[model samples]
Target: MKGVVILGESECSVKDFPDPVPDVGEVRVKMMATGICGSDLHLYHMDKQQAKKRGERIPGHEPCGIVDAVGNGVKKVKEGNRVTIGHWLGCGYCDQCAAGNIMWCEERRGYGGAIDGSHADYVIANERNCVLMPDSMSFIDGAFIACPGGTAYSSMKKLDVRIGDTVAVFGLGPVGLSGVILAKAMGGKVIGVDIIKERTELAKKLGADAVVNAKEDDPVKVIRDFTGGKGTPLAFEASGSAKGRTDIVSSLCRGGKAVFVGAGSSENVINPGQLIGSQLTLMGSFVIPLWMTWEMVDFISTQDITFEGAVTHRFSIDKASEAYRIFDEGKTGKVVFEWS
Candidate 1:
């Protein structure tokens, strides 16, 4: 088997490894496509602490593929089934798992994070973690659904932006772009903000009513002006930048809601008086609940939306290092690995 591994700080290489076999109640999935995410970059840029913990794990969580083999007790899927692996691996009988919130599992584990992921010829997944996909869904599109697409859907649902409402999306990365697509699909007038010209233009092409180059002008002002000098009632912060977060809250109308969908470790400063005076709402959302993600896949299979178009680049597994290099450059949209 061949798999990608982190060599050191900001370094990675694809190396030969022993093939993975499905354990009891597990399935062996041949990787068809694996989407690269921001978390992968964090692993690629392994700091000392993360480096020690990453160990020999393969790096890729957004996996969509065909089942190649099944272990004892596995019955939900068979060898010919096409499937998408959910990011979280949990104990199926736990209360959390029953509630479809595997993210809160005490025995919580995840692929491409603490475990060997699908950035290889094959990966071992528990039957509970796999979602069988319909034939109508493309492998690349299914891959995106496992992460960015699911995250976007979950966050958008939390925002609950109404039809005809003006929504401002801060950041034009893949997730941010996903926000624009979903917001527009729901009939909201969307304004996208990003310092990168490529991303700003891409957002417009996807469905944003307006795109702001935050580097050149104040995003809050631009969004306000676009909405007839009144700020948007809804804002999504997907850039994970402190300035973006602050600007988004300021870019919202009084009594408006802002959803923080990006992952970050830094502390942010917001004035209590400002929040109270405006009666604004700030909600922080994390990953998609496993149960909801399963339903989302079914929802995706039925939608006419072009989620696959979000993929901006595709590379072979052999060019694993190059794939990471391009993604690390942060110049592209959802990047996926294709298997031959």
Candidate 2:
């Protein structure tokens, strides 16, 4: 089997490796589509020590595929069934797992980050992590459900977005756009903000009530002004930038809640006085629970949200490196690795 291996910064190659066999309770999935995520790009240009720590890595996390073979004890899915595996394979027996927060399990392992991910033709997946895909969704679209969809869903649930409430998303990337759709579906008046005009326009198409061009205007003031000077009751900071984090905090009304969803930054400096005085609640969200992921899949099947538009670029497994380059340059929406 052919697979991708990172040689160093800005370097990757197709290396031949032995095809994997499913272990007990595991299933072998024939790769159909895999997404190039933002974190994968960050890991690509790791400064020496970081590179050494993640030496000889295969980078891809948003994977969707069909079951090719099943190991003994696998029964939820059988051969020839299409499915999307959850990115995090958490211990199902842990206390966190009992509370439906499997992503925080002590034995948590991600498909693409900790081990070999789906940047190739085949991947071994635990049967417990698989989510059955609706007949209406394509494999490429299903790829987005694994990570971006799940993460966005988790963030929305964490904030408990109410119907008729107001929301401002501080980025217009794939995850941010997903937030716009989810917020609107929950009956919230959605406002999207981004420096990129193209992304902001896409947010409008996705049902955002207003769009703010961060480069041309002050986002916090503009959002507040648009919201009748009261600011949005809820805000989602989906850009992993210091400026984005600051803007989200400043654009909140008294007692407003903000959720931080994007990754790629290490440190965020925020004001304690403002938080204390405003009585604002700030929450950081990560991966969604398996049950929540299933709910998201059901919503996608019934709602107007479509992952087709979110995926703007496609490449074969061999061009994985080029796909990563395009993602790193921020020139595309969701670049997917399409396997035949």
Candidate 3:
């Protein structure tokens, strides 16, 4: 098998590695497509946060593929089945797992983060972490079942953005775009804001009623103005920017729910006073629950939801370095590594 590794700061390479095999309750997946997540880029450049936490990593979590082999006790799926690996790996026997929130397990882990991820020819996954998919779906689209869409679903579930409510998304990255689409699908009037003009336009294409280029204007004011001076009933901070968080708090209607879906640096700051005065419900959402991931996959499968825009760049297994460079430049969306 061949895989990529980030040895240290500015040091990454692709090399041959032993192929993974399924153990009891595990499955060996022949990785078909893997989306290059932001964490992957952060690890590639040895960003301070990931470097400090987990040095020299193989970072990737959004992987979709076919089950090449299944170990004993894997009753949910069998060989040759198409599937997407969930971002979180949790113990199935824990209380958290029993309650259907396996993502909260104390022993939770994720591919490409805590372990070798989909940036390879094959990866081993616990049965509980794999969601079987239909053969009709492409590997690239299946890959989204784990992250951008899953995260969006989780945030929406947490905030409970209902029909007829107004929602604002502060960011136009993949997750933000996913938020916009999900909000619209749920009957909310959706508005999207971002510093990048291209992403704003893309947001509109993804069902946002309006897209604000925050770099050229005040997003908070723009959202307020668009919402008839009342502010949105629900707002999501998906940019992982401190400024974006502030705008989410400011642009939310009194008592509105605000969901923070992006993973930002630990040093990020927000004004406690503003949140208190606004009476806003601040929520932090991470990976989606496995059940929610399945529901989201089913939801999108029903629509012609295109994952095309999100996949802005693609590279072969060997050009792993260039993949990180393009992602870090912020000129593309979900860059993916394709297996040849």
Candidate 4:
């Protein structure tokens, strides 16, 4: 088997490794597609010695593939089934796990972070982590649903966006762009904010009612103007930057709700006084819970939305290095590795 290994300072390579074998309650999936997430860029830019500490652990969590083999005790999933992995594994008996929010479990283990991930020819996952992919959904769509797309969906759900309500999305990266698409599908008017022109343009193409180039204009002002001076009823923060975080809070109307999903820096960028004054509701959303995976698939299917437009680049595993470099540039949409 071959897997990607990050060598720090924005470098990566594909290397040979022993094929993984599943244990009880596990299944091995032949990789069909995997997405390069914003979190993966953190590993790519690690210092040399720090990156070496990862030591051959593959770096991909967004995975969609076909079940190639199953181990003893695996009953619900069978070989030849197409599935998207849930990425986080938890102690089966924990209350959080029982509620399908495994990411909150005290003993949570994340694929691509704590264990060998899906940027390989084959990956081993717990049978419970495999969500069946419909025949109508492409592997790329399934892969997005595993992470970025799912994250956006969870945030939008938290915001409870409604028809005629304006949504201000503070970032135009993959997750933020997904917010644009999903918010539109849910009947909200979306205003995408980003410093990059290309990203703002992509957001417009993806159905955002308007876009704000933060580098050249004040996003909060633009959002307020667009909303007829009331600001937006909802906002989603996915830039993971201090300015973006701060601006989103200011861009929301009084009593408006906002959800933060992106992660990069730990800066205290919000003003508590503003929240108190406006009586706003702020929430943090991570990836979707295990139970929401099926719901997201159903929503995508029923809404007839396609995530393929957000995928700007695709590469084979052999070109892992090039893929990492391109994604590190931070100017494109989702970058994925696909297998025939």
3 against 4, candidate with superior lDDT: 4
Taking every candidate in turn, the Cα RMSD to the unseen true structure, in Å, is: 1.6, 2.0, 2.5, 0.9
- Candidate closest to the true structure, highest lDDT: 4
Model 2 alpha-carbon drift over 4 Å, by segment: 47-56, 266-268
lDDT of 1: 0.85
lDDT of 2 by residue, 1-340 (tens): 7778765577667877788899999999999998888777767776767767776556777879899999999988899888888777777788887776767889988776787898878889888788898778888767877877677778888779998888899888878877887888878899899988778888888788999898899999988898899877899988988889988999999898999988756775678988999999999988677777788888878885676666778898888778778787774677788977
Candidate 3 backbone collisions, by pair = 60-112
What order do candidates take by lDDT, descending? 4, 1, 2, 3
In model 2, pairs of residues that clash are none
Full-model lDDT, candidate 2: 0.82
Query: What is each predicted model's overall lDDT from 0 to 1?
Result: 0.85, 0.82, 0.80, 0.93
* TM-score for each of the candidates: 0.95, 0.93, 0.91, 0.98
Q: Which stretches of candidate 1 lie over 4 Å from their true place?
A: 47-53
Q: After superposition, how far is residue 69 of candidate 1 from its true place, in Å?
A: 0.8
